[model samples]
Target: MAQAAAHTDTQQHPIRLYLVVWGWLFILSACSYLVDYFGLAGYPRWSLILLFMMLKAGLIVAVFMHMAWERLALTYAILVPPLVLMVFVGIMVLEANYTLFSRLAFFVAGS
Candidate 1:
């Protein structure tokens, strides 16, 4: 049987990947913040603020956190709770919209 090769001394490590991922994450974060800061200008696409925030958060979680490297069960274990909470939040926000707008309308009319 062929023997395995003897282990060599410490191998050279590459810092490029780590630097690139971190740099990309920083850029994404800065861009998202810029969008939010400028959203105060009364632009029509203010919802893009939330979209960019979500995208930046997703990239940070996936890349910096290595969320894509886990098993399916582990991924579900980590992700399902947030998924459930977001669903609940969405439902609550939808429900609250009517109440909020109705109250605002009444307040405006009264004033």
Candidate 2:
């Protein structure tokens, strides 16, 4: 009897929340597909696709994976590392571009 009571006390999320998240996921997926369907190319297309993908992934993690209800420390633990890695990647890309441009400039000027 006590175990049944404890089980009942556990968190129960509403179906509506899951349904709403599913809807948003579908919409985001459609938008991602549309980026390709409309024949978009270059940075704008890639940016929009990446943005939608991130949004959908966030929604799945937060809602479906129940991360949204988790404690702040756990959320940070799960999310922070990937974000930091992305930052490092962006920094490396910048450095690489600078190196490439400098090399090109040096060679062109020398010639």
Candidate 1 TM-score over all chains jointly: 0.57
User: For candidate 2, lDDT tens digit of each residue in 1-111?
Assistant: 999998899788999999999999999999999999999999999999999999999999999999999999999999999999999999999999999999999998999
Pick by lDDT: which candidate is best? 2
After aligning candidate 2 to the native by TM-score, how far in Å is the CA of 74 from where it should be? 0.3
16-58 per-residue lDDT for model 1 (tens digits): 8568767877787787678767665445445666766677777
In candidate 1, stretches whose alpha carbon ends up further than 4 angstroms from where it belongs are: 1-14, 36-46, 97-111
Error of 1 at 18 (Å): 2.0
Clash totals, every prediction = 0, 0
| Poorest 10 consecutive residues by lDDT, candidate 2 | 5-14
Candidate 1: residue 81 Cα off by (Å): 1.5
